[model samples]
Target: MGTWDSLHKQHVDVFIRINLLEKALLGLLQNRATGDMKGAASLQKDFLKAFEQGMILHFAVEEEALFPVLARAGEKPRILISELLAEHKSIMEKHNMIVQTAAVDKDKILLELIRELADHAKKEEQSIPSIISQLTPEQLNNIDQDAKRLGYRL
Candidate 1:
């Protein structure tokens, strides 16, 4: 697959994963409210695992494949890449907070994180692929290779 295609597929995967996470977070909230501590903890474990593997790795792959190229692009693209990078950092911080927080506090933070991610995804879907489309074929091939090397199977 070409760079844009691989990245697009990954974006779709992340979106689906986000939807699943929303469901899991909602379940966690319901569990906590009903005094089902065991259930809540179990769901928390699952959510954490998925978030780390799915979202964190997705961010890593994007950084590896796109950031350097975007950095070399024109002024507007450079600025936009910085914003995306900042969002990734913010999301990671929130993920860390969710890990350390109490159950009662966790759901609220998770909800915020989910909403932030949903918005972030929308931003990327609007911008990144078009920037990527401007790359040469060789550059596109290299990006796909880099993403695969980083363990993002297309």
Candidate 2:
């Protein structure tokens, strides 16, 4: 496959994986809100781990490799990419807050985090594909390597 095509596939795959993680977290939140403490606790642990591994790594890859390529391509995407980065920061803050507040009413905090992450993921999925399409083969290979260095395969 061409470099851009391979990168596009990677982007789409990451989007799908993130969406799945968001859905899983949302389901956990729903279960928590319904008073399923045991179920909520179980899902909360898994969700937290996934957020750390999947979401954080995904953002790291984008910030380290993808966004720079988009920014260098043209000014048109800079603003949107900046906004996405800000949203990533916000999501990270919320994730950290939820982790910190877990000792007191962990379920409620986790539910809030899940909602915030889901909304952020939706925005990212909408914007990232277009940005990915603009990258060159060299850029994609750089991104792939950066992600690999960060311990993320995709």
Candidate 3:
């Protein structure tokens, strides 16, 4: 076989991380908050703490590295990248809300967070093919390194 030019390491890495986040969200969302209310609240709070930590790096790399490349590529791409950047901001805001919500309102906040994140991630997944096609392996590698520097693994 010839050299495998389609070596998309960064895309694969990001996808792995995204899949992990999706799994965690699915578990948290499917379980629903119940039984010992305090226990549920504590569980979600802990899960969210970890999730937020991971997403900070994830969002940074996308915004700081990936989006800029896409933004400069073309007008339609710039528009889409801007929308994604906005979504990143929105997701962070919602994440903060989830973290700050009172115990009594925790479940509702989690549900909303879940929905918003699901939508954001779905859009990202849909855009991945275009991104991979548009960006060179080296550029993606730079974004991947940036993500790693910000503490993302997988």
Candidate 4:
């Protein structure tokens, strides 16, 4: 396989992590809506921890490694990366809000946050593959190294 193909496989792993976060968020939202406040609170805490460690780290790798190569390839990576960062900010705000409002009737807010996260994951899954397909082997190796430095396994 080419370098891009190998890197694309690594990106798929990131997508799996994102999907896991989405599922956790969805479960928390459901529990919140169903009056399982205790369960919701616990799950929300766990979700936040995972999000910080997993999803955030994945994005950091992409921002530091993948996006720059794509930008060098004249693929509007700057704009895409900027948009993704903005979305990450928004998601973080919503997650914090959900944690703060867990004791209150904030089921709707939780649902909205979960939905937003799902959307963001979908966008990453769709965009990264095509971008990866265009990258050279050396570019992929750089991304793999960056991901490793960021504590991600290929």
Best by TM-score: 1
Q: Model 4: per-residue lDDT, tens digit, 29-68?
A: 5553465556555665665676666666666666676667
> Candidates' lDDT values, in order?
0.76, 0.65, 0.60, 0.65
Instruction: Kindly report which residue pairs in candidate 4 clash with one another.
Output: none
The list of candidate 4 runs beyond 4 A from truth reads 1-38, 97-109
- 1-154 per-residue lDDT for model 3 (tens digits): 1011122343344345444444444455577534444554455665576566555766776777566776877888888888888877776777777667656555556555656666676677676557557777787677666556655563
Candidate 2 vs candidate 4: which has greater TM-score?
A: 2
Better of 1 and 3 by lDDT: 1
The runs of at least 3 residues in candidate 2 whose Cα sits more than 4 Å from the true structure, single-residue gaps closed, are 1-35, 101-105
RMSD of 4: 4.7
Return the top candidate by lDDT: 1
